[model samples]
Every structure is written in structure tokens, then in C-alpha cells.
Target: MNIPFYKMHGIGNDFVVIDNSVNSISLNKRRVKALCDRRYGIGCDQLIVLSNPKNDLADVYVQFFNGNGDEAGACGNGSRCVIAWLYRKYHRTEFILQTNAGLLPAQVIDSQMVKVNMGQPRTKWRDIPLKHEADTLYLPLAGEPSAVSIGNPHVTFFVEDLSTVDPVFCGKVLEKDPLFVEGANISFVQMLDRQAMRVRVWERGSGLTLACGSGACASVVNAVRRGLADRHCQVKMDGGNLIIDWDAENNEVLMTGPTSFSYQGSFDLDHYPL
Candidate 1:
């Protein structure tokens, strides 16, 4: 079977999006990995599968898979990309997407811009699902990073200078730390001011991507909890900037950014083994 897909990106975090709403496609770990291989397939940081919604309130069900073929609970950047794709297809501005994490509400701000309500940040140790109970605000780690869950687990380390830290080294070492029962995305943040900060992320499954939406959200939440930043701030990543607003009144984190449509193509499923 030849599966058609759309290549899209939010900021610089790119994904191969497949509309499986008809339930005609079947994917497994091997196929997912092959499809995400840059050298061997339609390379992307992640692969997004859109299926018919199981929930009445949802317009579609979005499932995210990492480059390694692991299913992710949530992906903020990918979510925006999915919403943008839906908007283009259905010509609607507002949408609700169901994921493994939960229901996410999104709106198309414009042709290239989108905003997603990433739900609330989970701060408890159990929710972040650390090995045991520990202070989420300050985990017992080398950098004393703070942990938060925005549908996915993330640990943010605030540094005075981002250049001083090697995100690749730290992310690889800390992502699988015993402290995190499930691996976590590692974010190194350098605060430029109360309203802006520079961020570098080591994503859980995709490694060093250009940007990470959940990481940005988690970083700002941790920063605000530590009183280092305000509720609304700009998260500057290598790919671009994302506006994150932690609405205290609604306890929701709003992520706004721009998405790009790379191209559209199809690949033969027979080329990749199940």
C-alpha cells in the first residue's frame, strides 16, 4: 500500500504526518522507525498519525511516534502541525484533537500561525512519575533540574549561559536517569530577562531537535515556579521563538508558534517491514 503523507513543521521541529482517518494503514515499530530514518526513509523528528476521533468532541485523534518508533503521549510542536494540517484540509479555524495524553484544544491564528492549549503542567512527582517521591521543583540531580509534565515528562535546567552547557551530553545522560521512571526530555534554559529566555532541548526520543514545544512549556512553568520568569514569556529555541503563556486563572498553558508546510508525498508500505 502506498501511504500519502504531509511534511510539516512548527518552528523547526518537523514531522511526517499521515492521515489515517480511514483506518486503512497499519503501523508497527519497525515501519515507524524505518519511516523516520533520514538515510533510509522520509526522515522527520517524529511521525504523526491522524485517525478518526473516538471522542465526540474531538475532530481527530492524533498519535505521535518518536524517531525511535516509541509512542509519545504528547508533542506540542507536532500538535500544532496536526492542527494546521486539519485546518488546511477542513478549512476550519478551531479544532479539538484527542491524543494518548488527553484532549487538546487548538485554533489557527492565521495561515501559518497556530495556538494550542497544552492543558495544565503536572508538577507532582507521581505525575511526572519519578522513581520515587521527590521535590518536582528541585530534583536531586546534577543540575538540580525541575520536572514538569505537559502530557509528557520534561526536566528543565536553568543555566546562566546556554553556551556553557552541552545539551547533547546532558540530555543523553539525564534522559535515562534512574530518577525518571520513564525517560524525560531535557531542556537547558538561559533566561535573558523576565519575559524572554533561550532554550535548548534534548528531546526524549528524537534527540537534539531544532525546537521542542513541550520542553518550552515545561521550562517556562519551572521558571515561573522558581519565580525566575513571569506567566507569559518568549521561549527562544534554535529553530525559532514560541510564545508560552501559563494562564494562572485557567491553569492552562498556551503555546503559540508558526508552522510550515514542507511538501506532500507518498511511500510504499511494502518497502518497510512490519
Candidate 2:
């Protein structure tokens, strides 16, 4: 395969990106899953594929796949990596990119910081795709989780004790539950202070990672609806922190964070090597 890749990260959430625009790099689910295996492949939490826009509506289009090869609709962290990779190519600080979810605007805020406009979230029950719609904006599911759609479906549960909630256990069940046909990212959130929160997520397809951006945004939405915090807040994940803001007028949820570059390399095609 001899496919070239760049390793990038957002708040310690890293990815291996293959530029399909120039490489024609294609991997079956088995190979992509293997490439994400820490001990066998390139060792990334996920693999991001960058290709030319299918409809020519944007500069580029991104494909996000978890370590297990499930294609995720959106990935905030991977979006930063893809943008950073493009910036490095043109030596520009800002750019516009597209994804399976929607178009995203990105820029290098500082030497090592990047900001991304994730677009607005849809709180409609159908948008969140919860079976038997009943106002997902403040969805009072049986388990009492707040539902929102920011590129993907998310059900945020406010926990009294962050440690008491086992995200992996609960997330595992909720992700598969028929309520969410395509599955979803589940977040257990605990308000740390007026301005901060402790969050853990069970991401769809990927299970648990160091962090999940949409999870943070959804958490803030849930927290605000529950009157647990103000509209603007900081969400602390296992890997790091993300800034989330809710714009009522625009009906948008904005998340800010950093993306990092780790290394550049290539792999042979005949085998998926770690």
C-alpha cells in the first residue's frame, strides 16, 4: 500500500490521516480496523480520510472512522487534524472543510491552538432520531438523559458523582438500544463548578476515547437545560478540556480546542502494520 499518513491530535485525541485526494488510498473495514490497532497498525485512536469534495461544494471532504472501522458522521478532533494538515500544506492559518455531517470552518488560533466552528445543533426529536419523538431538546428519556444532535446523536446524563457513573458500561448499552437506530455517543457529565464540568463519553463505534468534542457540546446543552450551569462552560474530558458555548439566537453550539501534529509516515499496502 505504501500509503502516506499524518498523525494529528486535538486535546490529546489523535488520528492518522490519509490524503485520499492525492493517494487513492483505500482500505476495507478489516484493514482500517487493523491500522487503528495500537499494537498492529499506525496506532491512532481513529483514522481520518481526507478526499476531494464529492459535490464540489467545499474544498475537501472528510471521512472519520473509529479504531473498529465504523464510519462516524462527525469528529471534531479529527476535523482539527484535517484542517491543520491542510494549513501545513498551504502555510495558511484558516480554512473551510466539509464532513459527512456538514461544512466546518477552522483556523489556527495560536501557534499550537486551533478553533473550529462546528455549526449549529438540531434538537428536534427526529433530528436526534430517538424513536417515538417527545422533545429531545430536553428529552426526558426513561433514564433522564438530555438529547441533542450536533452532527451526531448524543444523550448526556448529568451525574452527581463523575466517578460513580461507569461510562463504558452505560454507554455500551445505550449505543445499541433501538432508541438510537444509528447508535450514539453517550456522555456522563458532572458539573465541577459554575464554569466547568467533568465528562466521560462512550462514543459510537469507537467506544471510549480520551475525548469526544460533540459529547462536550451535548453535555453543556444538557447541563444548561437542567440549570446545572450557564450557557458557556468548560468541559474537562479524560484527555483534556474543551470550551463550549450555546448561541440561542443562532441555535448553534460552538466548541473550541487545540489540535496537535505528531508524525508523518507511510505503510505498506500488502499488510496492515502497526
Candidate 3:
């Protein structure tokens, strides 16, 4: 079957967005992994499906799967890219998307930027869903990581320099740490100042990417909880900068960043074996 798709990205975290509004689309594990393969298939950090909303509260139902074919609860960057696509096609700026995490309200600021209200940060060991009960503020682990969940679980380590840390080695170790029952996206963060920070993330299923929206949001929230940064901060990643604000009053996270369309095309599902 020929499936139409849009190739887009927010910062450097790209996605293959498939519109399933008109036709029902189904993807299996092998197909998802193949589609994410850079050399053999349409490359992307995640595969997004836009379906007709089941509930009246949302404009559409957005689902995200990582390169490994695992469905993630939330994807901030992917949501922004979806907003960009919806805006381009519908000429509408605001949208309510229901994701696996929950309802996310998004806005297209302009051609280059989009903003998403990422809802509240989940702070408790049980919420982060760690294996044992402990302080989320200061997880009793190596590097003294702080745990936070912005729809997805994350463990942020405050480091002096992000470059010095081995993302692959550390990520492989910490992502499977016994403390995190569901595993976790691992991030190394450096505080530049009260309003700026540098971050690098090893996403749980996607491995390392140019950027990670949920990781950025969780990092800022963790930093703020630790009194390391202001409620609003600029998170600098390898791909680009994302403005992550932990709204003090509303207790929600607002992420603003740029998104771009690389191209648009169609893929044949028959080309790949199930």
C-alpha cells in the first residue's frame, strides 16, 4: 500500500508523519523499525500518525513511536511539528491534539516557530514510576540525578560540562538503572545562568538525537525544582535552542521552538516485510 507522509522536524528531531484521516493505516514493529532506518528506509526519529479524534475535546489523535518501534507517551517536538503540518494544511494556528500522554494544546507562532502547552510536570517517585520510593528531587543514584516526568519519564544529571559526559555509555547504563522501573530518558544538563542551560539527551528508545522536547521540559522543571534555574529558561541543544518555561502559576510547561519541513512523499508498505 502506498502511504502518503510528510517529513518534518522540530530542531533536529525529525519525524515521518502519516495522515490517517481518510484511510486507516496500520504499522507493525518491523515496519516501524524499517521506516526509521536511515540507510534502508525513510529516516526519522519517530513515526507519527494523525487520526480522527475519538473524543470531542481534541482536533485529532496524535500517536508517536520511536525508532525502535516503541510507542512513547508524549513527544513535545513531534507535537510542534504536527501543529506546523496542521497549520499549513488547514490554515489554522491553534489546535488541540490528544496524544497517548493526554490533551496537548498547540499554536503556530509563525512559519518558523511553534508553541505547545505541555501540561504539568509529574514529580514524585511513583509518578516518575521509579522502582522504589525515593525523593524525586534527589534520586539516590550515581551523579545524583533528578527524576521528572513530562508525560514521559526522565532522569537529569547536572554536570559541569555536557561535552565531557559519554552520552552513549551513560545513557545505556542509566536508562536501564534499577531505580527506574520503566527505564528513563537520560539527560546531561549544565546551567549556564539563571535563564539559560545546555542539555544533551539520550532518549529511552531513540537513543541520542539532536534534540528532545520532553527531555528539555523535564530538565527545566527539574532544574527549577532544585533552585538551579528560573521558571523560564532557554535550553540549548546540539540541533538548536528551545525556550522551555515552567509556568509558576499554572504549573504547566510551555515549549517554544522552530520546526521545518524537509520534504513530503509516499512510502510503499509492501516494500518492507512484516
lDDT of 3 by residue, 33-103 (tens): 99999999999999998999987999999999999898889999999999999998899999999998899
- The residue-level lDDT of candidate 2 at 35 comes to 88
Q: How far is candidate 3 from the true structure (C-alpha RMSD, Å)?
A: 0.9
lDDT of 2: 0.82
User: Best candidate, lDDT-wise?
Assistant: 1
Span of 10 residues, lowest total lDDT, candidate 2: 135-144
Candidate 2: residue 103 lDDT (0-100) = 84
Candidate 1 lDDT over residue span 1-274, tens digit each: 7889999999899999998975468889889999999999999999999998999999999999999999999999999999999898899999999999899999999999999999989999999989999999999987788999999899999999899999898889988999988899999999999999999999998899999999999999999999999999999999999999999999999999999999999998889878
Q: Which candidate model has the greater lDDT, 1 or 3?
A: 1
- Best candidate according to TM-score: 1
* lDDT of model number 1: 0.94
Query: lDDT values of the candidates?
Result: 0.94, 0.82, 0.92
Q: Under the 3 Å rule for N, CA and C atoms, how many clashes does model 2 have?
A: 4
Candidate 2 residue lDDT tens string, 1-274: 5788888888878798988988976677898899888887788778998888875657788889887788888888788777778877888888788887888877877666677778887788888888776767555565678888878888988778988887788889988878786788888888898789999888887788889888888888878877888888999999899988887878677778877888899988788633
Segments of candidate 2 deviating more than 4 angstroms: 55-57, 137-142
Residue pairs in clash, model 3:
none
RMSD of each: 0.7, 2.0, 0.9
